[model samples]
Target chain A: MSVVLSIQGLTKAYKPGVPVLKGIDLDFDERGLTAIIGSSGTGKSTLVRIINRLVDPGDGTIVFKGEDLSRIHGRQLRELRRRIGMVFQEYNLVERLSVMENLLCGRLGYLSPLKAWLRRFPQEDIEHAYQLLDVIGLSNFANQRADSLSGGQRQRVGIARALMQRPELLLADEPTSSLDPKTSVEIMELLKSQGEDNKIPVLVNMHDVELAKRFADRIVGMTGGRVVFDGLPSRLTDDHLKLIYGGEGWLQ
Target chain B: MSSASIPAARPFESSLGAKLLALFILAYACYALGQLDFSWPRFVKGIDNGARFLDRMFPPSFKNWDQLLTGFIESMQIAVLATFFGVLISLPIAILGARNLMPSWATWPARLIVTLCRAFNPVIVAIIFIKAVGFGALAGVLALVMGSIGFVGKLFMEAIEEISMKQIEAIRATGAPFASVVAFGVLPQVMGRLVGFCTYQLDANLRNSTMVGIVGAGGIGGTLFAAFQRFEYDFVLAILITIIAVVLLGELLANYVKRIFNGES
Candidate 1:
């Protein structure tokens, strides 16, 4: 196994003294699904956001492919971002645009603004986008506006968009929080398979313990902005859940 | 649940200062009416003059159709050119003025430009342009362009500001360039409203183009104003009908644009 991403001494604060993420460290060794579980406001979302620099960390070194992500700027930063695909919880598809247009957003980094404005994405990219739409099971919805889709269908498009990036690592922040149980399971399965198919690590931050246990290859439990348990799913017992979530009442 | 309970204080309490303020406004309105000589007899006399003038205005004659056609065509040209250039220029300015996207320094200058454009009326701006450009449709177009920029630019900035940043963040996550972010993320969120605004601006510019001509800018208004001064009320009536026809046609075009852009009626 080889380390893909490594975070050292990660710390962040929205206010001067109130830290949302304390000093923490993490590493992804092989292509697998790793779920980070914590209760609301326990910094689960912040943890994933820091990886993509969506939310900057106050103090840390995020090393991806031997380069410190925090130190990069401009074109280098964009190149680094290209290697990491992030699926948002709210789907975030451009509502007014068609599904195909939104999916082509995955290739925005590669295309120039002039090309994008003229709808001149490479022929291969357009074909690949259509293929991804099929993979996400919305082949006929290519021209439909994003706002017309259901919650599950929209998330499917969201997944398709991220996959279009062909990233080295995929990050999903509470991707299932806005979905129903059946849809959540289906989305988790879709994400897990994409990680397997691409041979890239998938990092998911969620609060649904059962869903995580069912889908994740490994689970990292967090509490009070710090990792309290990191191991295989079978090893995450109720005691650890209590420690991570700080209550046994939720177990019932 | 607490319907029987009495509240500690009245809900719609009118402060004493508010009452006094209302009274003062009423008193000031009366004083303003007196200062303007807003008397009933004056209004009656004005109505008598208007009645006679209206009687003379019946049976419009288009005997001088060539001049009327030239002025009408010029006005339409001014309106179309102004809308095209104004929307083009204001689009970029509005994007720069969006505070959520750009730094304060960038936003401030763009906002200031838009503010200055909107501060003056089209007629006043037309007069200034007429002086600089020396009485032509160029002045009318320039004046209306500034008006369109001011009106549409502010609305566009507000539309950009109201968008979901999460959409932008998703695009940014793809490592897209800044221009691509705006093209893919920002523009889509506001394009519909922006298009609606552009159509509205075109309609407004059409109406204002005619008015600007009165100030020696250029348009049908110059012909109409000359007819008025020459006491050619019958010709004046002809020009008014043409203006009304042009305005109606412009309204139809605007509605068509709106429907096409939004894909709805």
Candidate 2:
């Protein structure tokens, strides 16, 4: 598979001496969902955010589609961002806006502020938003306010919003953490299926090891700001889990 | 655990300083009353004068009906124009002053401007505007606009700051421009509160519009002040009643607007 994004010598430190991501190097393929599994506070969220330039990196070269993402700013950065879609853990839909409007938010990069303010989204975008609502099985909820939706429904809208961008890359930051077990699986399934259907690479940060193993083609385990294991999920054994998470008490 | 060794429970803590302060306030008030020569005889005479004043104010005459109508129209015009311009100007200033949205360089100047606007009361501002604009409805409009900016700008900036950053982050991650981010992410969160602030400012401007006219800024207060100066007590009474009615009507309208914006039928 062709590599869609490559990270080289990535390092980040929030404080002067304390580093969150310590010299990370990885690449994402153009297809399949790859899950990064780790315990809390292991820089999983930071890694995901850094990829989208949400959190500035201390030092590194993030090469995506023949461009150095770390160096871009202003219009260039926005242009790069439009090509990448991120699903937040909180399903951060604008709560007071309708579901249809929230989905249209994904198209804000292409529309002028005046047009967006006037809510004059193009016909194609409106149609695509309607299609996405259907795909997420919320066709009847297009006019409903985002705050009124259930957590799972909101997450579905979040995913649909991301897909509205027709992004080349999809990044999810613990998209299932706030969800119940059953809903988590459903979200994962939707993410995987959507990724496959769109022909876009998916990089997901998750703590649920079983869900990751089940949905991901490949799993990368991280701990202490470094990747300790990278391989197919079938090959990720108890020993690897012990090394990545540390301690065996929770293994039982 | 003997009863003798157990400390008595003091649930209500009283401060000696508080009692001393209260005593000092009462003593100062009594001293001040004495200094002002506030005795029973003085109070009785004041009450007698007030009764005579009330008697003169009865049978309110609307003989100056044309003058009263013109003043009312002018005041309403001033209020509407002030609110319109105030809201228009405050939106950008509030956005600039929002620390979360703008850099420190932008917020500092914007905040300073808002503070300056709020530093003077509407009457004081009216005086300044009258000096500059030469005594008309324009002065009243300009003064109340400043008041509106001070009130709405500060509250709107606070409202912007209090919005959920997560929503903004999501929008930014979509690669949306700053304006689009504000349009979609920020505006929706604060729109309802903004409407509420605007309606309240309109209500305030309506009241202030009348007062600004007293300073030759051109509203009903000009006519009312003239009547008072001439001891046209009945005319003054009529103006006061009309003012009260107008204010009540403005309040009812403001509430209706607020309700509509709040999505209430």
lDDT of 1 by residue, A38-157 (tens): 989989899888888888778989998788987777899888888899998999998888999999999998888899888899999989999998888999999999999999999999
Model 1 stretches with alpha carbons more than 4 Å out: B1-48, B260-265
Compared with the true structure, all predictions reach lDDT values of: 0.92, 0.94
- Give the runs in model 2 whose Cα sits over 4 Å from its true position: B1-20, B34-42, B263-265
Error of 1 at B165 (Å): 1.4
TM-score, each model?
A: 0.93, 0.95
- Give the per-residue lDDT digits (tens) of candidate 2, residues B54-135: 9999999999999999999999999999999999999999999999999999999999999999999999999999999898
RMSD (Å) of each candidate, 1 decimal: 3.0, 1.9
Q: Per-prediction interface RMSD?
A: 0.8, 0.6
Deviation from native of the Cα of residue B43 in model 2, angstroms? 3.9
Flag clash pairs in model 2: none
DockQ, candidate 1, vs. native dimer: 0.77
Interface RMSD of 1: 0.8
